[model samples]
Target: MNRISATRSELLARRAGIRLAIQGRDLLKEKRTALMREFDRLSADAVAAMQDLEEKARRARASLSEAVALEGPEAVGSAALAARNEIGVRLTAKSVAGVKIVDLEHDPVGRARTDRGYSLAATSPRIDTAAEGFETVVEVLLDFVAVELSLRRLAEEITRTTRRVNALEHVVVPRLEKERDFILNVLNERELENRVRLMRARSRTDERARQTGGLAERSPA
Candidate 1:
């Protein structure tokens, strides 16, 4: 610890620092509270999205199984090969509580039977059912991932803010208070010492005056 001067100036400066530290702690506390609220709200949505994603995946798998049974593995494989298309994903960004949130934007996944790239007459309708179910699953999966990412960012921000608040409250403000108290005590002691010295000096001066008066009184005439 750097020892501060035993003066009023250092005491005032320490007091100012203490006030700023307290204000900073309060602001960070507010930020933490806001982050928690947002996280709670999005966490609920994330749970529902996860459940929906699981259900969609299960249904998609069942439909694929039926398609394979009804239309032979070779035929289904041929259709899958023809219908395989690269999915385009468009991503955008937004901010919430000083955190970056990623948004998933894309075209609708469902398509008409004619649009599936396979000859409608050759492919069983079961293939289309399976394809549609899986596409829906993909869409929901995207939504679920987006929510999970947001929650993660919020959690991180909350942690950082909490740390900052703790540092100010536990470390910074207390240190300043200690320094201020030290300065105050030193100044008080110095003032007391000066007063004692002044009293001794006055006493000596009064004694010299009394001695001179006694000599004058004892002198002849």
Candidate 2:
């Protein structure tokens, strides 16, 4: 490491820098803690959402199999082609502990037979059951994605904050403190040297004066 200048002003500046670094480190530590908390919460949410999605998916698969068995694959394909793509997804942003995350909004899925945009007379009950089950799966999957995304962002922020805190605490702050100590020692040494020089000069002046007085007192006139 390069040596710091041993000046009083330099020492003061180093001390101030260390103080600011310490304050910044503390704030980062707090931020890391908060992000970790949010991450944990989101993680739990994601897990629950995943479990729900899995169950919904299983049910949807079973219902689809039943529909295929009852109405035959050809009828189910015809029904799927007739169905309208009416699902609307709207996303909004939210902040969690300074991290931004996404929220979702959409039209309600799995409506009544009249609202399903398909003719009830044409579609069998098994087909309707399969449609509703699949829609539930999609909804739950969307929720799961949102939760997982938020968790990922929070985890990244927490890692970044932790790195910053460690750098300040272990590297920058310690270097500044060492520089401050070095400058102080230098200043003290200079002060002691100056004091010693001044004392020696004063002693020489007193000796000269005393010798001149003795000569004057010894003279006859």
Candidate 3:
């Protein structure tokens, strides 16, 4: 009887364990889904930002080349200085879906044209044009770097979360469930055997009592 009771208690405990494991599996799955969605959105945004930076860089280079050819290197330098003064670079930090991105600044300045319509100090038109063109290129590169880094970091985090979810769903949770089931089955079988044994014992006891009563009556005392 004691063994049977112990088995019954074990079965109850196993059932509880199964319930907890199942709940954990469900929660982890939800978290994985959310992380995947975030990863997708972030990846898309990073691609778009890279394309925009590239396009802008190309246009800036073209403009610088035209200005240098018309006015000379001196004019290009003046324009660059002016652009820098007019529009200074400003940085601001931003967070997207728990990922942090440093803010970027884009400031382009054009130099004033000389009386002769040439650059003030530099005479090489090609040199001036190249310098102007590179300013835009530099900005584009910076933007690309920021986006790429953020994307890489976000991807890493996503991968980590996914692994954890898979582990819980495929390995940890299943093992727990199997063990719980085994315990319950063992408990049930033990209890059933105990019930059968008790019935047999009770039957024997009743038969013995009846035989004793008959003997006592027949013996007349």
Best model per TM-score: 1
- The residue-level lDDT of candidate 3 at 137 comes to 65
Candidate 3's TM-score reads: 0.66
- Residue pairs clashing in model 2 are none
Error of 2 at 111 (Å): 1.6
List lDDT for all candidates, in order.
0.89, 0.85, 0.64
Query: lDDT per residue, candidate 3, 131-182, as tens digits?
Result: 5566556656766665576667667766776677677678876765666667
The estimated TM-scores of all candidates read: 0.89, 0.88, 0.66
Tell me model 1's lDDT, rounded to 2 decimals.
0.89
RMSD of 2: 2.2
Ranking by lDDT: 1, 2, 3
Candidate 2 residue runs with Cα over 4 Å from true position: 1-3, 209-221
lDDT of 1 by residue, 103-220 (tens): 8877777778887799899987899999899889988987787788889989999999999999999999999999999898998999999999999999999999999999999999
In terms of lDDT, the best-performing candidate is 1
- Residue 176, candidate 2: C-alpha displacement in angstroms: 1.0
Instruction: Looking at model 3, report the run of 10 residues with the lowest lDDT sum.
Output: 109-118
lDDT of 2 by residue, 32-88 (tens): 888888788778888888888888899999999999998999988887777757778
